[model samples]
Target: MKPGRPAAGSSHWLFTEDRLREEVTESQPALLPLDAWHRARGGRMVPFAGYEMPVQYEGIMAEHLWTRESAGLFDVSHMGQLVFSGDGADAELEKLLPGDVRALKAGRMRYSLLLNEAGGILDDLMITRLPEGHPFGEAGADDLYMVVNGAVKFDDIGTLREHVADRITINHMEDRALLALQGPKAVDALARLVPGVADLVFMRAGAFDWQGVPLWISRSGYTGEDGFEISLPGDAATVFTDALLEQPEVKPIGLGARDSLRLEAGLPLYGHDLDPEITPVTADLGFALSKRRREERGFAGADHILAERENGAVARRVGLIIDGRQPVREGADVLDGEGSMVGRVTSGGVAPSVGKPIAMAYVPVAMAAPGTAITVSQRGKVHHATVAAMPFVPHRYVRAGA
Candidate 1:
């Protein structure tokens, strides 16, 4: 299985066998078995990430505010989970990525990118080294667990198989479901359901048993809050979710609010801020390139990535704070102080937390720094804007000893 080009009309550059399904129709909605769980809780289902997921239990704005103030439950089962293992697994993975996967300690997780030979990001993902005692980590199989974007799962899996075919084994965890519980009070709310999880530090993951159901819990989330992403068998997903929601601090949130939250957190969305044409450096994700990896230059596109790191890239991704109540959306032109077109907005919305319109765009490196005055063209109007620091809302990740 060699990595091949994505199918026609596909959003990603690659595809997986399991991801090839007929188009979703109103008569045959793509509902997960857990649909009954959401329906029982009064959730409104909508298509998202290629799966029919709950958009809200109450409402977007209410759930959004509650998460910010407390905790919110989100069904992210649509995310693709795959296991890669065999001899030289790390080495093979390095050939396709720019991250330092070999250095990741067991029980730790890392955010990395799958890159094409040209250094363009195919998809961003989270990889974790399963602990020695884990089921996936038996002798003769050195395994790496991955969670990828649902929209690109098929393509992503194909790419992985092609790159490491015969050299490694790839297993898609289709039996599992992913759930994200996020917000300032996420730890406190989850503690009552799964004790000791609140103590896990950012980027750390481990297996735990909750009421006889096993779960892979990671102390991480996209909301820039103290939160967790739990992976468990599909059969137990609703059971675990319902238990968490029983806490008064937890509410159900939707994709609309999820988008706004990540925007405010300065996190990049794959198809929007990241794609096959965007390299990590130009995407302002150079931090994800480990220091050792930069020095070693063993990963794919390392030559170009290292060169850009040393000499600096021509274009840089940046955050923008727009004036007025009107929001500037993706594809909006970004202009310099003199009103010359400089770039384009990749993602934007009225930030629920910031109480104003915010956006992210890529501009000439010279104009990417904070305090740079700029203009955004939206609906034929030029709006006053400025280059702002990311995380329109400050991150509140809980540290190990915090």
Candidate 2:
């Protein structure tokens, strides 16, 4: 709702560098550990998630295409890396997260939602249990690791503290810097630097050491590519990044490409596609709800989410393919054939990889089927669109099926 800024939903959504910088500069946003490094590389800096970060380097389109074909390094240190410790960690986590923490094997992670009592998503996150006998700093092996959206990290921490028992300790790993290396050639570049990283399968994490500095790596990322997320001491970030860029395949990517890549992957970003008003079922993220947890119904918001799961939610998120050349921005109104506004778009743009304008929106369940006709109204212009399956471009995560 700020003037001249794109109403792209999330704070990390679409932004023009000048306007974004103007708005965030007055706030005195904190700089990333690699702040100087990004500037030295010609990264166009913008304010996002209370941090001065890069929105694009070479350019969004070129960077996006490069990441699809090769590998792109992204500085995502803004995301909060939390390590949960203490007695009954697994059981305590299950009380808030919809996923089956107890059933999760060591060194594995799963996408999960932090739900309130109403089943509405507070935040979407990934939870990983450390490998057996693998301890993270002062935390024991049984401690759990979580990566949460940076924009809502403080709120997420507050939610956990208020809900989980006193024995559980939430350590915010702010001193660490997180980096994501993504694309088909990611493994080729990463393996050369860290030999054993090639063994980590999708959704699995492990502990490693890089030049005397400890690293916690997970073979998972936001761009839906076969990649890895590395957590290491902030001081080592520059050196490690330098080494990775030395590879012929790796390049520093910015936020613009990151957003487009995730959109094309059919991944919903927190705060934009997801919020307190949207449940897992409504967001078309039922897979995050584990089979065992669904039967037990012990997690928060289980009652409403389960009922919606069984009977079907009134409105469900679906993919939309715009019929024209121009892209549809978020906040566009979704209209039925009769012209009544039925829903709205959450994330949308001209998908660079797909070469078509694609979007994710919420609409009546009856109109959610693929091939259904829909209308989008943006900036006083009406555009025709069709309901379609997501991932306008297919996901290429390594070991996705395995």
Candidate 3:
């Protein structure tokens, strides 16, 4: 870990701007399409996932609070967008993920995980089946649109290529830029530019045209708010982002606030909370494994995962509410009542929204229940905390008729 930065676990990285810039400046890191635009607006550039992206513009705390109350625009072009097509696309995807892909209706999105042979997560991704008769560029309507983490996209693509049959075509949409518009007023703000956007229910997606620019939008986000993820041509990114900021409800956000927002939502960062060694059951993400898929047991590592799901995993990921004001950083040792080391913090920090210290960690199943007592040892100081139900703040995902 870099000095003065939190050593968070998994693939989720917590990087300080100076350290990040220092490491990548020597490597000539690639710049995002909106690189210059961000620089012009006081965006502090940092190296993340091979892209020089914004860490913050105003500040993490303010950005986080603003996103919760209004809307925040985020540049997530660093993520990889993939379109998989073929007659057997759903079947092919099912072989890789334990999701009920075959039953996925057109224009619906599903949060799924790519599992290895051992049921350990390769990466957590969003999968959307394009509306029938709605083709994405060269890909057909039957194609499945997937968005994966930037850090592991290459590895994910390679693994998919190795496992999927030849008929399945994988087209990497590298020419696109992804943006997230999140918060309570997100729908109202976006609808001003793209009419009918407010109609997209949670977990739903559609292809729409905004000011002559084609957009593939999904009503989903990592912030656990009612929001949208827009995929547009790389060249149109700056213009679109600028347009969104024109609204009083929207402000440009950086990755620092993005991390805190997700953490407070009880969402796990891929690298920090999930890894090749962690399984869905262990991560408390068993919902990603569809029920029918569980019965069929055809996906990778089904044998072990099914057994673990039935009998219970040895250790499980859970939320912790620290008793004091001091925030605990990741890698801190978690001790049971007897003070024996039982686990370690994976992701933790001051939750601006929650107004207290909250963390996520793995502990033995017996100690994973809510209200369980635990102690964290960080920097030679011991702090008391209790197991709590996650999303320290309640998720505000807008559901239909709500």
Scored against the true structure, residue 241 in model 1 reaches a CA lDDT of 79
Stronger candidate by lDDT (1 vs 2):
2
Every model's TM-score: 0.90, 0.94, 0.94
- The TM-score of predicted model 3 comes to 0.94
Question: Which stretches in model 1 have alpha-carbon errors above 4 Å?
Answer: 1-29, 135-141, 337-340
Residue runs of model 2 more than 4 Å from their true location after superposition: 1-26, 132-135, 400-402
List lDDT for all candidates, in order. 0.79, 0.86, 0.86
lDDT of 2 by residue, 162-185 (tens): 989998889998989999999999
Candidate 1 TM-score over all chains jointly = 0.90
- Candidate 3 lDDT over 1-402, as tens digits, reads 111234543322333453344333356778888899999999988888788899999888889999999999999998999999898889988888999988888898899999999989999999988875553686475788999998789999999999998999999988889999999999999999999888889999998888899898889999989899999999999898899989999999998889889999999887778888899999999899898999888999999899999999989999999998877777788887787788878878788888888889888899999999888888678989999998789888877788
Every model's Cα RMSD, please? 5.9, 3.0, 3.2
Task: Write one digit per residue (lDDT tens) for candidate 1, span 42-156.
Answer: 8777665567776666666677778889998888888898888787787788878777888877878899999987788999999988776664435343678889998789899
CA lDDT for candidate 3: 0.86
